[model samples]
Target chain A: MKMVRVIVSFLAMFFVNAVSAGVDDTVWKNELKTQFFADRSISETENIIAIEAPYRAEDAALVPIRITSKINQTNDKYIKKITLIVDKNPTPFAAEFNFTPLSGKADVAMRLRINSYSYVRAIAEMNDGQLIMAKKFVKASGGCSAPIGADLDAAMKRLGRMKFKLSGTAQSNEPNLAQLLISHPNITGMQMDQVTRFIRPAYYVEEVKVTFDGQPVLTAKTDIAISADPNFRFYFVPQSSGDLRAEVSDTDGNTFSQTYRVEP
Target chain B: MKCIWIVSLGLCLGLFAVQCQAKTKETLEVQKIAPGLYFHFGHHELPNRDNHGAIANIGFVVGKECVAVLDSGGNPQQGLLLKNTIEKITDVPICYVINSHVHPDHIFGNRSFKGRGVQFIGHKNLARAMQARGGFYLQRSEEQLGVKLAPKDIVLPDIEVTDSLTLDLGHRLLTVTAHGSAHTDNDLSVLDKNSQTLWLSDLLFVEHLPVIDGSLKGWLRELKALSALKVRRVVPGHGPVMGDWPAALKPQEDYLTMLLKEVRSMIRQGKFIEQAIAEVGQMATGRWALFDAFHKKNITLVFAELEWED
Candidate 1:
């Protein structure tokens, strides 16, 4: 009886230990360090780049991230590219933005999926071979698990219908802000179909481009971290009284475009 | 014999610990937001890697003979616990249950009060929203919380208030104000006159950032109106009880003010949406920490609404 009791105790202890070893916070931190330096280098100079986000997110998966640059305005040169990276995402590269002077302030905002509390870094490369960066930490979790508020079929039915709004007097000297609302599911592939228990495949907004009067304003390339029903906003220098056009294409080959007339 | 006894003791202790931990009834801390009103802080727990912390709040108003509950809880079981807590304190039956909005967290526990013949109240739009998405919400709750809520558990609101309505809780007079086209079209706020307490469900997220699925202008106006009210205390949908409602109002109001002003300014400057987002970066940084997640989204929504023609 003593021998049986001892064996049972030992087995129970072993099972508890086995379960505890699976989750490692250090592993997540280490993975972030590995990806932090993958393609971008940190810079110390103030490069007129800024990222605005909520200090704490109401929803982790749908936390809005925006990146903007002022370097081009001071130098009359355009930015080559901008990257939004989340240090801890399974795929850390949230989005990459490309721009031209016609792209205006090189700013863009989109909803993203955050697996946990993590730092978000926005890096912009100027045409003059300079990289400027800004970082903000957002507190939002369970974005990957949040249920789609709308029916899958209904959400899909309205996918890719874009709306553009250019507010303020078009004739004013102030810069015009144009917003684009895109209807897309942006499935991160990590979520399971609730009914099927099958892992959904990754599909997101891979790229977006905006044009002001036929002048390129901003371009974005993203990963699976984008939330469903992604909406984007940016600034552009409206030169003439022409239509501001937006052309967006997701990874799934879905393309959408909309044009709003600028007030003279 | 000694070794066997020691082994059995260890096993018994382990079983006891398991049972203790499995007891999920947590003692909730309640605070009086108004004279006759109380708000209970819902516990925050992340049970699984994929699940987010539950942040719903429960509110109740004590009257002469009965009490009214607003927004039961996140689950039926939780609602049962809340009911038990209420029963222990008072003999008054729960006379009314009002869902401030149709969000699952705010209304999922409707079933716990159904069999008791309580009068359930909500916006006229809630029944449709629930009927459309009730099954999906149930499935997700089960998947995420490991707790299953039956379809029959949800009780449709017998009283649908449109515009505004006042409820007389006998000793305490409570006013239910409906703010259409903010947060959600069916949003409502409960105000208790005797205690001068206002239960701003989801309208005011005290310490946490406010989520705006509604009109920024409308929400801002509602906040302004509430700020002008003579209430002594306010109970937010999420966060601790608020003694100074204005202190809790700043972050959200500041955010909306900054978004509308900055985005409008950039629009006037002829900057497109992308440029405005970049240029408006960190404009309201020092005010609130949660600005990062909501700032740009606010700008996007505000810009869309402002630019829309009548």
Candidate 2:
């Protein structure tokens, strides 16, 4: 009877230890909850906001993420803010994009960082008191340790030369997709300088504003999760022929702007 | 029973260790990039304390009286070995030697073909870069590989192409076009007309993560243009011969496009440099294993170039 009791206890202890050895789900959950509410409150509710990205990215530092909103039912409504939070990053809040009605649709396609295998959350707020959320888990790592290609001096030479590629012709009623390619290291603080052991100071794009024919269309405010050399692809309803302008500024007092002429 | 179990475990562990060691060693696989063009596929294995020579892919085009050699291997010894291999396949002598780019692994064996009267060719920019960095490259290579490489032994390109040039090997015509700034400021592609073979140097890397010291957009554009060519075979700078030119260009093009799109968005958002690096974390996934080593560096270069104003 004593031997049987000992075996039972041993088996029970083994099971308990195995469960404890697993990843701390509560830790990640707490991190997500804390980061989502760091600046604003959020509640998980169903709405038209959706985020598209691979569940497992091949490259961790430059994962493609797309956020789209199907809330076209109302004309006056606009997305006030869109936030992407990668739960496992040292700083979970990846990016926050602010938009105005000129933004045609509450849509954005950008790349972001993933520190590890973690869940990514996209929270969108409408003009009215409505919060819509979408979540996805991605498996990726080592984004913080990759090296920047150019030397510091070389990288700063031509910092903000923008190229805009309009996907569709102006005649086509289909919403034109504009792809803006920008140049910036968007260095995250977690990376160590190759020559120096000291961690690099955090430098990333803080805000992006896109204007169509001098009218405000889209604006974005982001954090460390924004990948280097930011690329923005979004759609805008082309009313007529005009110039599309984008002005971008980083935290380091560097401002770059470019204008592309749109034709009918 | 215990002894037998121990022996079985030992054998299993031995097999596992051997498999692990084998995996670590790179496999050099050669494939036909075009009908008659071929290139070896493998990363340059940096020599250890015992190994004396480095490895690189040497490409050639067979002709009636002679063959055209593109980029020699790491050392004179490697160069001789490659020359012998070429000689065995063709009875003609190697008449023209072209250095695809100015990296040492691709140019170090220039001395081996020195006395053979091989006409050396390269981009105008390569000669300048080589001249400027020849001494430094030799010194570092000798120190790293524990072998002496004199700058005098390095052969400069006797023939320099600025815009475009052609080499008519009688039976096969090879058009050499200098594409504007890719992989490096001076990148050249050798297109064989008869076989529709395109020796793309380091322009396209298959499976391996591409190293970009040049313009990301430019390289992508170059690849796109190359894909449109009548290329039936493609010999890359470091990998196996790509049978499918368009399919081969997709991975490289996709990678660059992804990098450009991602980095451009970050710059637009006003993400600082540090944040950009952090946020762009290992962004791509699958098939390509060394994506981590090359992606970040590519991002940095792309960011710098894209942000640069005229």
Q: For candidate 1, write residues A1-264 as lDDT tens digits.
A: 769956865665465345332333453346553554454555746557888876665455466677766554434676678778876566888787777666556777776766555677787777887777788776543311242222233336577777775555665333566677777767655432332223346666787777776777777776777766666777777656787888888877878888887866
lDDT tens per residue, model 2, B223-276: 777788876777777666777868878877877788788878876664533345
- Candidate of highest TM-score: 1
- Candidate 2 docking category? incorrect
Question: What TM-score, to 2 decimals, does candidate 2 have?
Answer: 0.50
State every prediction's TM-score relative to the real structure: 0.54, 0.50
Q: How far is candidate 1 from the true structure (C-alpha RMSD, Å)?
A: 10.8
In candidate 1, stretches whose alpha carbon ends up further than 4 angstroms from where it belongs are: A1-264, B1-27, B32-35, B43-54, B131-136, B149-154, B245-248, B266-310
Candidate 2 per-residue lDDT over residues A46-66, each given as its tens digit: 567888776655446567788
Which lDDT values do the candidates have, in the order given?
0.66, 0.67
lDDT of 2: 0.67
